[model samples]
Target chain A: MKIIVSLFTFLICQLYTLAQVNQASMYGLDTSFLNYNTCELGAIHEYFSYHAKYPESTMSLLKRVQDSVVSHPIALSKNGFITFRFTVNCQGKASHFKLYLLDENYAETIFDKTLVLFLYDFIKGLNGWKIIKDKSGQHILNYNSYFSFQIKDGKIISVAP
Target chain B: MVKLYLWLLSLCLFCFNNSNASAQEVVVSKIDCLDSKWQESAEQGLFHAQYATGYMSEEWQSHCDSLLHICPNFSYIWEMKAMPHIKGGIYDFASLNKAVSINPNRQLPYRAFMKCIFSKDYYGALLDLDSAEQLVHGGGIMDHSFSFYKGISYLSIGKADSAVLYLQKDVAEQSKRMGLGNEHYNSLFYLGLAHLYAQQTKQAERYLLASIKAYSKFPEPNYYLGILYLQKNERLKAKTYFQMAQSALNNGYNMNEDNNIYVDYPFQISAVEIEQVLKE
Candidate 1:
């Protein structure tokens, strides 16, 4: 059984600034701009590499997530990755699904609508992203999360943070 | 007379046995939040439960005994045990050294933040608070306090802009945490002071006055209000606020009731500054 190491580390810095500066005009993340959650990037991958589920309390849930990843089989090229970015609204429901197929350097590549549908459906199925609202209580601040997959042949080999 | 003496002796013996039976009953009772379960739990090696009970108890000796019974090698216990000392304004580095050695994720940042503040390491305090914030799972009292201290530490280091940034965020977060109508008076007061230091007079006045309006008995806001009016060249209004601050000198800035430790940081220093201004 392949172990899927997921960091679930979605950088929310863009939301941190835009939430305060211009809440009304903010949108989902773009690949062009840099992500600040990069601080834990290297350590997170290495930490999860050997250690799968952690902190004891969330072990069952994480174990279940990893189990599901292995169960679902996906077709892919020799190398590259598939990514899905979504906006988890103030209610914690994942929405506004945006799919991306990228090369090793992370440049976006075009994919068929069916492949996009497959990724979107999977990301929309996720249930645990934390939602935080602005102080005014009138608007919902959006936090971004990603579900990234490393593909080998017709199955998933590993997962990105 | 001999018969009466013998009867009295028998009654005394009966009463002694009755009290001993009562003590036995107390010993066998189920331990909960009340009574002296902490010592028992500690002796049983229930370390986490012992830590929790010691944390909430009034008797320090029993708590200290419980702390001692634990294996001091785990820094989490040392950190938990150190809470009372830190709260009472006494800093003990032995326990802190043990804690710093382990650097346990959950409790370390919170205690280390206190340690940094004790050492007057404002920048270090900021970094510890950031680490605590990232690792903290929920919106607990520590999270709110970290937000408050983040601002205060920046202000202490004379970084008014950065101070204002965190203080504003803290006030907003506190207000939300306290519910819609409730406001964090001391936090708002500091936010106003931060704004004043940052040269944003209008926002300063708004927040300071809001704090005074929230709790008129609080002296810091009144004293700072005086400073605010003085900046505007309104001597009479400044004098009014200064007198108000003087009257409330004994009424120190209230301590945060919601945090783990009972800490007090009054704004009495402002009184000296006001006096100097008045004399000039």
Candidate 2:
């Protein structure tokens, strides 16, 4: 069991980037590049660089999503987390969305196509992202952010860090 | 000219990589940050590693990795390296296992804490906590008793009976040590949740109210109180509690757990839930 877990961890680390690439290809959906109207033209900063924040509380945003996004029960057989990694630019516009799905055990997996697409569209449509200022509060910065949805029995359980 | 540019770029990368390490080398002597359990070299490595640029950064991780290379048996470095992975929602048990193997008394509870809270692997947490209980004497980690986390894990995994047992033990121990009404608010909150799950509504309400009294701005107890009221078909009371929960959240009150910034706690509620309940 230990050996298997080690091997799994090794594979996950080695193929982490590849998994993102494959997610798009496997689903025939290119969530990789989104054309945002308000993105600044410069180097995209790391998330930890400026410690950017969302415009509203993450819980509020998630609550709104759970109430509205999953309009009907999805009969998908899988239960896991759907995480979207994206960039929010200086102008508070998010782009470059990448999706990663993992099971309760944290192993990578896929969910229903309709469900995944619905979530992808919902995240892409989300606005009012906030660009955090530097420590001196002078410069506006772009940063990467992750949005993850915990799912159980085809229902949206919660949003997480 | 092109070769000179390439050379300069390589030098810049090298400098960037070693910037934090160089800082460590300069100040490691004056810091006085040493863990007596490990060797001096390992302690120094950990101290220096802590001075790395930022957590989850390549430089910071590489600094830890380099330290591990020097002192492979150092559990702190392994734990440090595993943190980013855990917070990022990747459960790297191998590194955590390595840490536990080296120092079970110190790392087991930590691993259990991570499993219970961050990874939401309740069963796994219980296993580690059980082992930690065997190895260590009476103690706590991350500011709560081991039994507190065990209770939480059992509650999370739907074993309300076990959760209530452990949580009650935690409350008794805490009350005995710190005095009544002074146990950790989370303990009361989870006790309420466990009772609620077990259909023991009166007990649930008692503990939930105690939790609220302990920390009024805590949204979770208010939210669960809303659920309890709803279950009792008290719509107006439920709405009021839900509104309170919503208001608390809007005011930026959240679970005060140390790692709440990195992961959501079990039974955490959101504004939408409150709003939905209000609408109903």
Candidate 3:
């Protein structure tokens, strides 16, 4: 009887330990955290690689446009990331680009019109190519690229490589 | 004399029990009668008032009064009041806020959000939508409804891309579960709008047509079709679509009004733009 009671107690302790481990794993995940990590890494790689290869020629137009426009500073902790999805049209122009996963402040506070217009101008200067049919019968090169960005403290920290 | 007193006491007990039972039966009967009458009168007055003044009748006001007298905190009475305000185009943030305060757990927020949209307060509507979404987070029918409104709110704010994300999410997650019908129609309509705003013209046309096919009586698809035609520079076709939209609204087939419901950009293209397109 003593041995049987000891075995039962052992089994209960094991179950309790297993439950704790499971709960701990789940506690690490949330909608915001997961989105931040995935989007941040992807955007950093893409933006860094593109900026390196093309250098001044490709992004100069975007810089000019950004300078022309009035922009508010966006601040975020460097600890997290967000995933964005956007369309780059045939002209290497970004259209319909948006941050799908955003921090609460970015999502709720950023005006939609300001975001879209900024994206439109920035994307227009990207150096990429998408084939779209023009008024002529032949396909022509367009600068349409859609991708994500990892932004931290008003800086492009990372992009999809 | 002691025996006589005992007999009198027993007689009194018997009479008291009989009277109490009779009184209980009478109370039950009166309650049942009151319940049925109140419901019928309230429903009738609500319907008539909605039809006559584009609002609820003060005459039907008696039904609500009667109901409140009996059950002061009834949620349905407040909902009935909301219907008229919504229909009469007088639904404001204050009225809806009052309704929500009265019954936080009920579907008052949903109704109130609609009124907010009608009143052209997209920001207020979105705040209500956010609360409603949180309230119904477990992906039920109400969740689907809330998501649809959320998508609409995004669209109104000119975040077509965001609108598409939410609308498509609703379609993928909720529409399939709910099956193909009214919910499906609503999903398609919003999805079509998303595509249109994204400049996916062909896809927008297809989805909008499908929405109209799903519900022939719905006016939203027709209105959007007009916008689509305008985009394509097909002036005559756009005019026809606009006329169809107007006719549908006039015939009372349109469910939601308040033209600003879908207004997104700060500088909306004037109705004159439509007329100019038609003239061309």
Question: Which candidate number has the best TM-score?
Answer: 2
Candidate 3: misplaced stretches above 4 Å?
A1-161, B1-55, B92-98, B138-144, B173-175, B178-183, B215-275
Off by over 4 Å in 2: A1-38, A41-83, A90-94, A97-140, A147-159, B1-52, B137-139
- Highest DockQ, which number? 2
Could you report the DockQ of all the candidates, in the order they appear?
Answer: 0.01, 0.20, 0.01
- Measure candidate 3: CA RMSD: 23.5
Give one digit per residue, the lDDT tens place, for model 1 in B36-63.
3433333333244345544333443344
The whole-model C-alpha lDDT of candidate 2 against the native structure comes to 0.72
Better of 1 and 3 by lDDT: 1
Task: Point to the candidate with the largest lDDT.
Answer: 2
Model 2 chain A worst lDDT window (10 residues): A16-25
Candidate 1: residue B258 lDDT (0-100):
44
| Candidate 1 TM-score, true structure as reference | 0.46
Badly placed stretches (over 4 Å) of model 1 are A1-161, B1-40, B43-70, B73-76, B80-90, B100-105, B116-119, B137-143, B178-181, B251-271
Candidate 3 overall lDDT versus native: 0.48
* lDDT, candidates in the order shown: 0.51, 0.72, 0.48
